[model samples]
Structure formats: structure tokens, C-alpha cells
Target: MDDKNSQTQTQINLVVAEPVIDIPTLTHRGPVKQRSPPPILARFHAGYFRISLSLCGQAFLWKTLGKPANDSFVIRRLLRLLPSTAFLLLWSIALFILMTLSLLYLLRCFFHFRMVKGEFLHHVGVNYLFAPWISWLLLLESAPFVSPKSVPYLVLWWAIVIPVVALDVKIYGQWFIKGKRFLSMVANPTSQLSVIGNLVGAKAAAEMGWKESALCMFSIGMAHYLVLFVTLYQRFSGRERIPATLRPVFFLFFATPSMASLAWESISGNFDTPSKMFFFLSLFMFMSLVIFFFF
Candidate 1:
């Protein structure tokens, strides 16, 4: 009986020792493998690439709108005038070239399986492209020899064109992507209002009212961020349906005010005069109809 008990204890000890040896052998067979995370530099490059693509799209719109000014003859006629015109022409050319390069880079990145960050880039590109137009119009107004009266018309025309092009792009992204509806893309109250706020703020700044402009821009930026969060929520929750009444409200409260402000600023020279009033009114009505029916 004593010998049997001793044998049983020995067997139990061996069983425990076997598992300990087996565990060490298994662990030593190979080093634990770990997945490396994507590098920060790669993320930065992806962001830049996306922004460049959006800018390229915006630049394409501008290029299609009008031919580049033929200033070579004007340059020959006046050497002094040549310097400024040459500078403007060269700057514009550089912008076009950079836009193209960025677009090609974006395509390469996409095909190579690099991350493509599109949303912020799209917004930034649109704003950057529009900046030149705004600057040119402002320069024309502020030049000692230039007339301020001409500013309004140019501003009006540009305001209409930029938004229309953006809207078209938004529509294309929606319909073709097929993951989301068209109105869902643009009908975010926060985003729409934020854009309006930015425009108003910029306009107010030009008039030497910085405080109001700052406040407006800040409010708009906040609203835009909120809208982005809301969009994510809707996407996750699968609640894509916006009320029927809200559709018209978006047209009225958001689209109309934007168009009206642009029109008003564009026609600021003759606000009190009756002659251009009808023209401006017609312009507003036309844009309103387009936004309501189409967008």
C-alpha cells in the first residue's frame, strides 16, 4: 500500500512537469508576431494628397469658366504694366500646375492602397480656389484708380457660379456613389448655415467690421463641426429620411439667404437705385427656383 501511494504521487508530479515543459517549448518555437500600425507620415501625406485633388477639381471649374487673359500684347505695349500682369498670370499658372500635380499624386496613392482622406480636402480645395476670385475682386475695388461700383456685379456672378459647381459635384458624389441620397448630402442645416456665416463674416470684414465677422465665422465653424457629427450619427443609425416640410425649409432658410446675401453684396453700389433692383430681384428668383427644383 505504501509503494502504491508513492507511485501515485510520482505520476501526479510528472503530469505537472510535462505541462510546464510543453508550455516553454511552445512559447520558444517562434517569436510573437505584432502588426505595425500605419506611420504618421503616411497619414499626413494622404491628407495632403486628398486636399490637392479637391483643389484640382475646383481649378478645373475656374479654367472652364473663362479663357486666361492674353497679356503678352499688353506687356509689349507697356513695360511697367507688364510686371504686375506677368506676376498675376504666373501665379495663376503655378496654381494650375500644382493642382494637376496633386491630382496625379492622389491617384497614385489611391492605386497603391494608401489611405485617401477626402472630406476635409474637398472643403479646403473649394475654399482655396474661391479665394483667388475673392482676392481679385477685392483688389479691383481697392486699387486707387479702380472703381468700387464694378465690384458688386463681379461678386454676384462669381457667387452664383461657385456654389452651382459645388452643388453639381455634391450631386455627382451622391448619385453615383449610390450609398447615400442626394438631398442627404447637402441638406445638413449646420453645414449650409455655416457656409452662409463664413460668407457674411468675410463681407463684414471687408467693410471694416471685424468683430461681427469673427463671431460669424466662429459660429459657422462650430456649426460645421456639429453637422459632421450629426451626419455620422445619421449614417450609423440608418435614419436618412428628412421631413418633407424640412426640404422646403432648407431651400428657404439656407439656400435663399445665401443667394440673397451674395446678390445684395454684389449690387451694393446701387442699393437705393431702382434701375438695377429688377435685375438683382430676377437673379435671386432665378437662383431660388434652381435650388428648390433641382437641388
Candidate 2:
């Protein structure tokens, strides 16, 4: 019995020592490399189309209004001359810069969030869409010879504003309603200081009225930066956990128009009747969609 057991152990050892070889290596011809999917040139193409569409839209509006082009014609012409390749290059550069800034901002927000407790900064990074839009609006409004009717333009502006405010109320509920954090913060000494300063600047500009476009300009600038910071913070902190149903609203407010405005602002030198009208119109459309759908 002992010899039989020894023989079985020896057989097992022999089998184990048979020198196994990897089948893949034995059968291999050359390197087995993983194939990656094709790069998304489609999105790039889409971006170019969108940019072209915006330019065409601007041109159409200007032609419709019979407005004469000023020195801004140079910038507009340059943009028009941008070939598809150049457009792609410009977009790539801009996207890279934006992405880098977004990452940095997100890191800062994360650091801040860790340092603080339940004091979550609401939608910080996610709000960056406002910057380019504000910039575009400023450029449009500052055009050399373009003066759009203020009342009609303001109506368009409220279209976006009212809906956005309403959406904020709906999504945030009591926070916006009771004016808890938002109102409190707005009323805070520090916040109020800034607000008052802005209002004063705006009022002074209103008084001077011509070159004193300072207040609205300042407001636009401040809003742009604020949106950028809020967007970055929200992105990093993952606070904008908006459900799928609410995603369209979120995109409307923060995504589509934001990108469109950014592109328009980046290339356009002068914002005139066309740009302002578009800005207000876009805002109105977004807000209207939100109000109609959500509210």
C-alpha cells in the first residue's frame, strides 16, 4: 500500500513537471494589439457646423436689419475666412484651455469642500457656461454702430431670465423660495457690498449713459466669473445630481447656449444689434423651454 501511494505521488509530480507552455505564445505570429475605436471626428465636425450656423445666423439677422458694418467687419471677415481646418484648430485650442481651467477649478473646489462641512457650494463649476455668454453679449452690445431697440431686446432677455429663475425655484424648491441660503448670502455684508458696488457702478453708467455702459458690462463680467467658479465647484463636488428628467433643463441652462455663446464671444470682435438680439433671444428660448416644460 505504501509503495502504491508513493507511485501515485511520483505520477502527480511527473504530471506537474511536464513544463507547461502558454498556448497564446506558442500559436502567436506577431504582437497581439488591441484595436481602439476611431477618434470622434464627428463631434469636431458638429462643432464646426454649429459655429458656421451661428455666423450665418448673425449675418442673416444683420442683413435683415440693414445695419451697416463698422470696423467689426475685419473680425467678422476673419471669422468668415476661417476654413474648416482652422476652425477645428481653434476649437481644439479653446477646448484644451477650458478643460485645463475646469480641472484646476475643480481641484480647488474639492479642497474647499474637504475643508468645509455641509456648506456645499451649490453648482460652482457647472455654471461656467455663463462666462462666454456674458462676454458675447458684451461684445454684441458694444458694437461700433449697432443699436438694437432696447425694449424688444429686453423682452427677449426676460424670456431667458424669468424661466431660469422659475426653474431655480422649482429645482431648489424652498432654497430659492424661502430665500434661505441664496437670499441670505445675497444679503450678507460681503455679498451686499459687491452687489451694491455693482449697482452703483451700473447706476452711474446709466446716468452717464453713453460710454458708461460700465454697470451692465461689470455685471456681465462678474456673472461670467461667478458662473465659471460655480461650474467648476459643482463639477468637482458632484452636487448637480440632476435626474434624467431634469437633464434637459440643466442642459438648456448650462450646456447648449453656453457653448454657443462662448464660441460667438471668442471670435467676434464687436457685439452689436445682431449679437445682443441673439443673446437675448437665446436666453429667452432656453428660459421659455424650462418654464413651459418644467413649470
Candidate 3:
């Protein structure tokens, strides 16, 4: 029995060490000796959630940060002179349309429970499930019509943040309870998204003046992030598991700290010392990545 368990562990290590990902065959199956693209990719999976997520984040930046960033003399003198809620509204409408279409596809049409089950079990794909909710929360935070302390706002926050907290339990619970064939073996940069999603939720909670809730969410995200950060930093597992095309996602390294700074700033009611440290760290990481690409 011990030998059998040892052999199973060895096979998992071999599968993870490979550079190529057989998305179709990521499920548990007997040795099939061949691989092909999963038809499911064309159908729909949580993996594609990242597409609209990227656009939603960009819109969030424009609406939530870019418009108000007129402290610079040039921006204040010229751009601030031109009032254009029109562009922001246009972007918001487009983002809403995209989110509607994407959610309709993911949830309305048959809702592939089997495929979702597979995604939950698959390490890389599972992490992406967080992207959709993260996108929605960012859009909500950026929505001009929503009053942060209003009843509807509170309801929507619960509707979105509850799922994130639930997923944290299921995923992080597994990380805590399972020592074999899990977390340490499969932790990847994508896992960082799960952390980011929680931080995003924390920021939203803080916006609504829910300080206790914000700290609770923030602690969960930062705790797991620290563990995963060290794991990926040391290349403890799943480092080579990513493909070259996905290397750009390493940018998320700095993004995590950037998001942390914003969340902490909101929680503390000031961009205080800890927030400054986080911001500086994010800047340093951004420059490090820039230099990395330069050479």
C-alpha cells in the first residue's frame, strides 16, 4: 500500500513537471498515452473568464482612478478643463454589455456542472474561477450610480463577496487539510488571482465602510498570498508548469502588492506607513519586471 501511494505521488510529480498542459485530459483517467486539445475549450470553461476580466479592470482604472488623477498640472490644466463623463459612461456601457454576454454564456446555457467540477479539481483552471467575480466586483466599485452605503449596494456586495469567501474556504481548506497531491504540488501564479480577488473584495467592503469585514477579507487574502508567494518564489512546485505564452502573467506579482496598497489604504483611512511600504514594494517589483524584460 505504501509503495502504491509512493508510485501515485511520483506520477503526479511527472505530470506537473512537464512544460505542456493537456487541458483536455487534465481529469483523472487511466494512462491513455496520448493527448489532444479539449473540445471543452471551445464550448466554455472558467479559463476564458480572464478575457473580459482584463477589459473590466481597464474600465475600472479609467472610471475609478484615471478620471480623478488630475493633480498633475498638465492634466489639471488641459484635461480637467474638458469634462467628459461621456467617455466613461460609454466604457461602462460596453463593459456591462460584455459582462452580460459572458455571464449568459457561462451560467444560462445548460450550465455545465460537470465541466465546472473538472475545473474545480484541476489546479490551473480552478484558480481562474475567481476572475469572473473579481471583474464584477471591480465594475460595481466603479459604478457611479451605486451609493457605497445604500441597501442595494450592501446586497450586491454580499451577493458577490459571499461566493469569494466560500471559494476561499473550499480551496484554502483543501490547502490546509491536504498535504499530498494538492496545494504545494500545484501552487502557481494563477493561484495569486484567488488572493487578488479577496483583496478586491476587501477594497469594496472598505468602500462601503465595513471595516471589520474588510479586515477579515484582507487577512485571508494576505495570509494565503504570503504562503503562495514563498512557494512560487522558491520554485517549490508548479513553476515550470506554466507555458511561455503565460509568462506575462508574472506581472501579477506586482499587481498583488498594488492591490494590497489600495485595500490597506481604504481600510486604514489613510495611505499610512504600511500602505506606503506596500506601494513602494509594488513599484520596485514593477521596475524589476521591466528590467527583467529589458535584458
Candidate 4:
């Protein structure tokens, strides 16, 4: 009886196994065909991209703020081990892997244009689309091998920034042409991501000695940031509509100002009066939100 039941279960399992699709075979067999990725790849979305953003940001921070093992007395005592160069190299490699995986998944998503379009139209999903470009910009800035003034670096900047500007036009244009009702309807804390994308690009431009271009990008970002900021603060869009996953982006209230201050400093070449103001505002907001979230 047990052997019979076992044989039956094995047969059922074999019958229920996933299909092996051959696109060429299907196309040759008939005019109709569909291309689908493995189930694991199909489940990927913008939410899975958050980790790369965090990794790129940390890599950039380490490049800007970290010192060699020999140079840092306090850091040496704390970490008690590997050189900072090892850390940076590890992060750079990890970033490359993550970016490659993301690109492949994105290519798969693009193959299914309808799915990509649907995501583009989704209010929350649309905002997260800016993430990949932002990660690329951060990775560029943190690359120790590439000098900002190099021709290759210059070319790479244009490649990355152009998409950011294009997205700005697409998203911000909708807000402008569609007007306040549309803005109110779509506005959410993660909407601030659009603002950060501009600020990050502006900072990268300033690093490349493109002052006027930096200012232009910064102005557009700040202008819309103000509108989105106010709309979100006032709850004109209604708080309940925001997804639970995105509520953490409430932290952007402080982070946007922090990014703003950093971008202004890059553009102006000094942390002067306005830069100081932005810095202080971000600090206060960070502390306040820290308390709010904890309490």
C-alpha cells in the first residue's frame, strides 16, 4: 500500500513539473509564442533595488569620509582589522554584481513592455524607478580609479544624467500639466526620491566642474521638492493611501535637506550661509524624526 501511494505521488510530481519553453521551437511551430523568465526572476521589482542604493551610498561615504588603517587611530581601535582600501574594493565589486543583476532583471522586464508600462504608471512604483540611475551616479562618484575630469568620466556623467533629466521631464511635466489635483493625488513620502535624484546628479555635475549645469539641475529639484514637501506635510494626498512599505521614506524629509545642503556645498565650493542653513535644518529634522519614530 505504501509503495503504491509513493509511486502515485512521484507520478503526480512529474506531471505537475514546470514547462521547459523553447522560444524558437514555439515560433517555428506556430505564429503565436510567449517569452517568459523563470519564476524567480519574474518576481523582482523596484523594492528589491533598495539594497543596491544602500550599498552605493555607503561606498561613497567610505570614499569621502574613511581613512587608511594607518591614518585612523580611532577607526583602527574600533574595527581592529582590515585596511579601508579592502573595504572599498569589496564594496565596489559587490556594487558591480548588484548592478549587473539589476540590469539583467531590467532587461527581462523591458522584454515584457506591458509590465514595465504598468509599473511606470503605478504611483509608488514610478517613483522608485529613479533608483537605478541614482545608484549609478553614486558608484561613479565613489570610483577611486576614475578622475572627475577624465574624458571617460565626462562621457559617463552625460550618459547617467540624461536619463535623470528625461525622467524629470516625464514626471514633473505630469505634475505641471496635470496641476494640483494630480500632484495631490500622487504625492507621497517616496515622491521625494525624484527630488534626491536631481540633487545627486547636480552634485556629480559640480564635481565635474560644470557649475551652471549643476545649478540648473539643483533649482529644478528644489522647486519641485518644495511643492512635494508641502503637499505631503499637509496630507493633501491623504496619509492612508501611502503603502506600508513606503512609510519609512518619511525619513526623506530630513534626507532631502541633507542632500540639498551637500549639493549646494558642491556647487558653491563652500559651506557658506545658505549651506549652513540647509545643514542645520536637516539636522533638526533628523533628530525630530528619530525621536518620533522611536517614541
Candidate 5:
């Protein structure tokens, strides 16, 4: 029995020492390399929400900061030279991109539920979702100029705003009601922008003559902004752990007040005392930001 076992082991060792050649059943081609899908077809992640930066620029330029420049003689003359249809076509392209991204984002969230849920638990990730609603409102603001008296704009506004408001309530409930670490979470500037998104919606609602709804949204947004402001200030004053990559979001401190002023002025139909106060507050915040960063 021992001799038989030794013989079997020696045979196995001989087999192992011999290199077996893998004969190809068919002709071999080069290695299969995976190519990434095009942007349109690619699976979007939560990070795609940063496209809202474009929406912010659009809102700031056409809606608030550069409204005067947009109406200037040079631009007006240039616009006059182009066909009126060009404006609508351009806006249509932008709207299409926004809708496509939003649909893709939803699909990603659906397919990757656990991953997306984890992202939502993070303060920045939850705030990033607000980008879609912000872009929707920004696009809606251009509807009047693109096609005056268009019913589609009103329809789209209701479709997006109602759901966004519902989402805002749900998200804030989770963050404020359920979250025990809400104060520590406020070190992230992106979280405050979620509150600003309500103001964006309020501006659009006011434009559509939904005064009561607009007032409600604006009030809720301001109330939350105040709380978030204090919480973030606390984080800034302490030895909080903030990632260097996200430090630029601190500019949101100024942007929130600036946008609040714009929304207030829009809803009130006048640049009254409160609007002026908000604007000055934004100005002070801007100065503070500059001083903090520069020095």
C-alpha cells in the first residue's frame, strides 16, 4: 500500500512538472478591451448632479446678475441679426440635456439602490440631488422669453415644483428630524444650497402668480437657511474635519443671501427694505469670503 501511494505521488509530480499547452479551438484574436459608452448612454452617478453648476451660471447671468447686460444694445443688436427661432432652438437643446441627465440619474439610483442610499446619507450627496429641480426652475425662467404665453412652461412648472417640494419636505425631515448628527453635518456648504433650491422654486412660483405658494416656500427656505447658517458657523469656528476639495463651496454663503434677495424682490414686486437688507447681507458675506480666502 505504501509503494502504491508513493508511485501515485510521483506520477502527480511528473504531471505537474509538465507544462500543458492550451490548444486554441478557434483562431485567437487580440485581447477584448472594454470601451466606455458615450456620455448620452453612460450610467450616470450622483456626481452628475454637479451639472447644476451650469444651471447656477444660467440663473445668475440671465435671471439676476447679468440681466442688464443681456438687455444691452450690443447683445440686443446681435440677437436681432439672428432668427428668433434660434433662441428657442438653443433653449430646447439645453432643456433636452437637463431632462436626459435627470432621467439617467434616476435610472442609476434605481439600479444601484444600496449605493445611492449610502450616498443620500452623506450631506453633500443629498444636497446634490436638488440640482435637477434647480435646473428645471432655471429653464422655466427662460420659457417666457422663448415662447410668450406658452402653456407648456406652466405645465412643466407644476410637474417639477410639486414633486420637488415634496422631496424637500422628505429630505429635510430625514436630515433634521431623524439625524442626530445634523449639527456636525452642517460643515458641508452644499447642504445649505438645498435650502436655496426652495428659493429658486419660489421665484418661479411667484412668476406664475402663485403668490401664496411662493411665500410659503420662501419662508420655509429662509427658516432653514438661518439654522444651517448657524450650524455651519459653529463648524467653521471649531476644529471640524472638512475636506479641502469642498472648501470652495463656502462661496455658497454669499450666493444664498444674494439669491434670497433676488427671490424676495421678485415675490414682493419691489426692492423694498427687506430685499435691500438681504442684498447688503450678501454683500457683507461676499466681503467676508474675500477677506477670509485672500488673507
Candidate 6:
């Protein structure tokens, strides 16, 4: 009886046994499993994307209704409504959340500097440097609407913008000058972040009456933008390789030049010849994008 039971258990084990190796099939059938981004990267993915909100806020603030006003009860009430308040709230929340995430990200990188440097810092992490500063720009711009006389807010903006700008220098220096690895990473739209950050910084600086600093930042941004723009255009035009999910971000091609124009106008005090040229360039890019995307 014992021998019979033992034999039965062995037979059960054989019946349930799994293969130790995957057998190669003659035909491929299933969808391939896509590799996920690393944990450190995936955690701050949302932070990297806060630029979309910043851009939207900038457009609404600078282009559409103009800056928020608290001169009258009616205007203040209007600013408090869903549309205006929504933009302010969205911009504020995005900035704070990203700022916190950025601090955490930096702290983690401190401990795992080797792995981060070898992997993300050279790749995805470099692109993310723009998000925090862009958030800062949005926050700086928001001060007038939130509190017109908040000196502390302005002071904080100055403090934050310096380090953010320095971080950009370090990262871009590594990529463009030291590593010379920019060409290999040109496909992603987020690569435009450095230029966008500078242009936005120019706007912020100009608002603070730092015209010289604004011009310097804007010039550096525009100089690099021209090269990046042409390279990215050449890259994307040759291939329909971008995933459909990522197609919306191509709007950034229009955004960078638009922002450059706005920043130039801010610095020059008028939309003169150069400013108009930048504006027209942006308009053309926008129109081209619309036609291509819709048609």
C-alpha cells in the first residue's frame, strides 16, 4: 500500500512538472512584452511632463487673457473663477509636486550616483532637468496673480532659478561638449527641454528687470534650438517610427520657437524686426504642424 501511494505521488509530480527552459517555436505569434522604464525614472515620469502644464499656463497668461489683475473686485472675482483659478491652481500644484520630486530624485542619485550616471544621467535623466526649472518659471510668473507684493515669493524664485540654470549648464555641458552624445538621443521631443527652459528663464528674468541676464539666457537657448530643430526635423521626417502615443508631443516643435519669440519680445521691449521674425517662424511651424497632423 505504501509503495503504491509513493508511486501515485511520483506520477502526480510528473504530471505537474513544468519545463525548465522555454522551447523555441517555429512561428512567432504573440505580442512582444515591452520593457518598462526603471523605477527611479518611472517615479518621476509625471514630473518630467509638468512642462506641458507650464506651457499651457504661459500661453494663457501671456497670450490669451494677459496677466491676472487684482485691481478691482470684479477682476479678482473673475480670477477666482473656474477658468483662471484652474490655470493658477494647476500651475502651482505642478510646480510644488515637481520640486519635491526633483529633490527626492537628486537625493537618490547621490547614493546611487554610479548606476544613475552610467544609465539615466546620460539618457532619460538629462532630459528631465528641464521640468523643475520650467515649473519654477511658471511659479515665478504666478506670483503677480497670487500676491502682487510678495517679496518672499520673488526672492524664492531668484534662489531657485540659479541652481536650476546651473544644473542645465552641467547636464548640457556633459552632453554637448564633454560626452558629445546628443546626436544619439535626438529622437525624443523632451530633448528640446534645455532650450525651452532657457527661453522661459529669459521671460522670468526679464520680468524681474534683469534684461542682460535674460538676453544671455535667450541667446544661448535660441542658438542651440536652431541646431536641435534642424537635427530633429531631419530625424523625424525620414521615419514614421514614433509611436502613436507620443505623437502629441510633436507640438513642442511649434512651442520652442513661439517661446523664443515671446522671450525676445520681453527682452527687446517691442516686437521689432527680429522679434517678428521669430514670431513668424513660430507661426509657420505651428501652421505646418497643424496641416500635417490633420491632413
| Candidate achieving the largest TM-score | 4
TM-score of every candidate:
0.26, 0.25, 0.78, 0.81, 0.72, 0.65
Across 200-277, the per-residue lDDT of candidate 5 in tens digits comes to 888877877788988999999998888878877774444345578778878889888887887888899888999999
- What digit string (tens of lDDT, one per residue) describes model 2 on residues 1-295? 9998887874334344532232222235775444332233211211122233234334333332333445466656666555646544543444444444444434444444442222223332223223322222332333333444455444434342343334333323433465433432322111211222232223223323423354353444345435433543344332334345333333334323333343333234355454465467558767766787789
Two-way TM-score contest, 2 vs 5, winner: 5
Candidate 3 deviant stretches above 4 angstroms: 1-41, 66-82, 104-111, 237-240
Question: Where is the poorest 10-residue window by lDDT in model 6?
Answer: 62-71
The root-mean-square deviation over C-alpha atoms between each candidate and the true structure, in angstroms, is: 17.8, 18.6, 11.3, 7.5, 8.8, 11.5
lDDT of model 5 at position 286: 94
Model 6 scores a TM of 0.65
**Candidate 6 per-residue C-alpha lDDT over 1-295 given as tens digits, one digit per residue, 9 for 90 to 100:** 9998887874334466643334344537755444333456434443344554555465346323444443555545555554656665666565566566666667656655665565445444456656666766665665535442367655766776686678667766765665335544434666677788888888877867788888888988888787777767675443324456656767888778877877888788776888888888879988998999899
Write down the lDDT of every candidate, Cα atoms only. 0.40, 0.37, 0.78, 0.80, 0.70, 0.65
For candidate 3, the lDDT comes to: 0.78
Output the worst ten-in-a-row residue range by lDDT, candidate 1. 17-26
Which residue pairs does candidate 5 place in steric collision? none
Give the range where candidate 5 is weakest over 10 consecutive residues by summed lDDT: 18-27
Quality of model 2 by C-alpha lDDT: 0.37
lDDT of 3 by residue, 150-188 (tens): 999899999998888888888898887877535678777
Compare candidates 2 and 5 on lDDT and give the better one.
5
Q: Which sections of candidate 5 miss by over 4 Å? A: 1-43, 63-93, 144-150, 184-187, 236-241
Best by lDDT: 4
Candidate 4, residues 69-161: lDDT per residue as tens digits? 336656545544557678667676757766776786577576656677777888888888888888888888888789999999899999998
